[model samples]
Target: MPKFIVSLQSNADYEAAKQDIEKQGGSIVDDSMKILGMITVQMSDQSASSLKSLNSGIISVEPDQEVTIQVA
Candidate 1:
């Protein structure tokens, strides 16, 4: 399972999408307004990929690629 960042489109149902994600075995990692309407969730990649077409509100769904920051 992988985590993803899901962005919602304008005129989209945020709450509906959130509920749908939970219903489909996804856990909301962060519902914070990353960019106003962006939600981070933990779920299988397959589930996240399919989420786009399943929900009209989804503008984009991308894997939360792990990044290692080097601070010197």
Candidate 2:
């Protein structure tokens, strides 16, 4: 189970992206844009790969990494 930040093109279709992601068992964690244009989601690596194959508007689907800082 990997989380991904799905970056999409400016002219992306929200409905199409939503449908594809949802169909692949991806859950909507946070949507960067108002609709499904830009979003952060929790999904399998397979799902991310699938999205890239089908969605032309997608810019990139990169794994979400956690960052921590030590304050002194």
Candidate 3:
């Protein structure tokens, strides 16, 4: 399974989004960013795509990646 960051519309229903994700076989990983209208989820690529297409409240579903900074 891959992790993705799901961004929701400002007026989107949070509960509805969660239900949509679960219906697509995805699980919410981190919702700490919900205040910012973002959620981290883990699911298959197909599920991710389905969620994106089926859920109108969702703005974008992007891969979750780590960023590192080096001090010189």
Give the whole-model CA lDDT for all candidates, comma-separated: 0.86, 0.81, 0.90
Q: If candidate 1 were superposed on the true structure by all CA atoms, what would the RMSD be?
A: 2.8
Candidate 2, residues 1-72: lDDT per residue as tens digits?
788988888898876877778888999888766454678889988878888887558788889889899999
Which predicted model would earn the best TM-score? 3
- Structural RMSD, model 3: 1.6
- Residue lDDT tens for model 3, 1-72: 899999999999998998899888999999999999998999998888777787559999999999899999
lDDT tens digits by residue: candidate 1, 1-72: 788999998777888889989987899999887459899999998888889887568889988988798999
Which of the numbered candidates is closest to the native, going by highest lDDT? 3
Candidate 2 wrong stretches, greater than 4 Å: 35-37, 67-72
lDDT score, residue 9, model 1? 89
TM-score of each: 0.81, 0.76, 0.88
Instruction: Tally clashes: model 2.
Output: 0
| Candidate 3 lDDT score at position 2 | 98
What ordering of candidates by lDDT runs from best to worst? 3, 1, 2
Where does model 3 exceed 4 Å of error? 69-72
Model 1 off-target regions past 4 Å?
Answer: 66-72
